[model samples]
Target: MHYAFDADQETFRRELATFAQKVLAPHYQPDDRAGRMRPELPREMASMGLTGLRVPERFGGQEADAVTTGLAAEEVSRADINACYILLVAALNADILVGNASEEQLARWLPPIADGSALSALVLTEPEHGSDAANLSLRAQPDGAGWRLTGEKTSISMGMLADTGIVFARTGGSGARGVSAFYVDLHDDRISRTALDDHGGRAIGRASLHFDSVPVGRDELIGQEGAGFVSVMQGFDYSRAVIGLMCVGIAEAALDDALDYARTREAFGGPIGRNQGVAFPLVEQATRLAGARHICYEALWRKDQGLDHTVAANMAKWFAPKTAGEVVHQALLTFGHAGWGSDSPQGQRLRDVMAFEIADGTAQVAKLVVARHLLGRKFAP
Candidate 1:
């Protein structure tokens, strides 16, 4: 029943928070405005072994547990929300590769990511299949000695910049059983990436990938064929928890900023924070943020202990992002006219938090998962 973080975890959190504030924060505004990923951030994260926190030590990683990774994600994201995006992608890719990739594939892929020489992005969502990933129309056909994959994946984070992608395509027939996962190199002539614009989390560089008969060897298969859906779901289970942490970070930052402004900005010759109208909303926001944070950490802890946490993870993923959006919206309102300006960081925070509401899974989809788990399929129509 211990609720507090251990000394080592606390130390890790403090170190990450310090690094994020001192280094990452300064780069967030300019890089996000330009829709560019920070060139040095990935290398810096690699230097600290943050990119490979969940990877095996044999693969040149620290082999840290999931809770530590979640803590690091929260700290970095508190300074700059986009930092969470990078960290989560790395963690998710590492977890998936470690759990499913063959020994030779791991040898080829894991070290570069650990050393920051390579970046990996998960390519599951397509233009046509957002939540219906099991029925993705992307086809990967047997071609001579290997496979030729042709499909278009849209709204993928780090899609343009990633050295490799773990893509799910249909190799069999229809539905979940037919899906298979493949690790494809983006450098192939048949693969093309086009950067997408006009979105929140602009610093992360989402894109659309067009694969035209891209060649992949048999070793690229992750897990067994027809087992791809299960692998992808497992990846989501890991990733959504981190995404919940990201929401908590962003909400905390926004609320802190708004509170600071409320305490300082004079209204009617007194601080606006003195008024119950302004103060109560702030209090409510803080309460919601705290609740969401607890849920996120509990889910992470359950995951680290290898407990069945699908329900808790889904709950956090559903509630945290929506709560964050509401908190940021309230924060923006507290800033008045200043919040509406594009020049203000609050507006950017709002847009960034909004994306999370739909990122890993929509609030509705998450609730569906929770409902199904709680009620069971035989409950009712």
Candidate 2:
């Protein structure tokens, strides 16, 4: 029944919004042109504790709850959706590590991320096996007392600049059981990176990472050998909802601009917003965005309360980005000509929001998860 943010949460959300507008919004369009994150971007966001939102205080982090983390995604993405990618990957990695890593492992691995000395990537996808991550071919050959990884991971967000990555590789027989997670130093000479020029989110430095005999000792093992898939997958249920919020944030920003245009721009000697044609589509999109936001927050809240949120999370994953894309497209149309320009956020917002529909699994895959949860596994797709 509670529909509003608590006093503290509201205050925090406002502070984040202000920071996003002042520090991140200015770079939103420009960074997309630069095709890489700025040197100070990591540390600046770290200073705000955004890069460490999910880490425990002992690790120099805020240990923020899932809802708080979702709020950060929503607020930050409104100004710069690409900047939110850093927080997204960081939160996912922190959650996975905290849930699975040994105490010693946590002690060593968590600090650098919390302190902004490290930027993290979840290395789960390969070119051949994306949604079917269980079938990934990246091999982690057993060495003396460790393993040597040799394979390629493409479509990696932050791969170009990440100092650390939790790479999942095949270690045993076929399928998911064969995979294990390794916390690897991406800066090592054994690893070579090819930066991807993405359609959007270029600021996050998406890339392909190739590992040729990269060493991973026993200490770098994240959890029990075969548990990596489950650990990482569990984190996704929550991160999906966070991504929904991020997608909604940019759409909301675009909507705001469209509304502004409708109010001031004259058409037929009157404000265009006065016409139902211009206003109704915006209204419909607004309603859809509102519903998506609620679902996203509900998923995050369920995770915070120790409830099974898979259904809500997947629903948000599929619904939010799709809704956002529609909303941004409608908003662009509202501008008529101004929105088509590269200078306008509408075009960039549309491109950026498009990625969420595909990243973290496509809408079709997310719907399939919800169907499986709603119907019995045998009865579902």
> Who wins the TM-score comparison?
2
Candidate 1 residue 195 Cα shift, in angstroms, is: 1.8
Candidate lDDT scores, in order, read 0.85, 0.93
lDDT of 1 by residue, 207-285 (tens): 9999898887788989888788888788788778888888888788889999999999889999999999999999998
Per residue, candidate 2 scores C-alpha lDDT tens digits across 141-182 of: 999999999999999988889999999999888988889999
Q: Which 10 consecutive positions of candidate 1 have the poorest summed lDDT?
A: 372-381
Model 2's alpha-carbon lDDT is 0.93
Q: What's model 1's lDDT at 49?
A: 78
**Backbone steric clashes in candidate 2, count:** 0
RMSD over all Cα atoms, model 2: 0.9
For model 2, the stretches where C-alpha displacement exceeds 4 angstroms are none
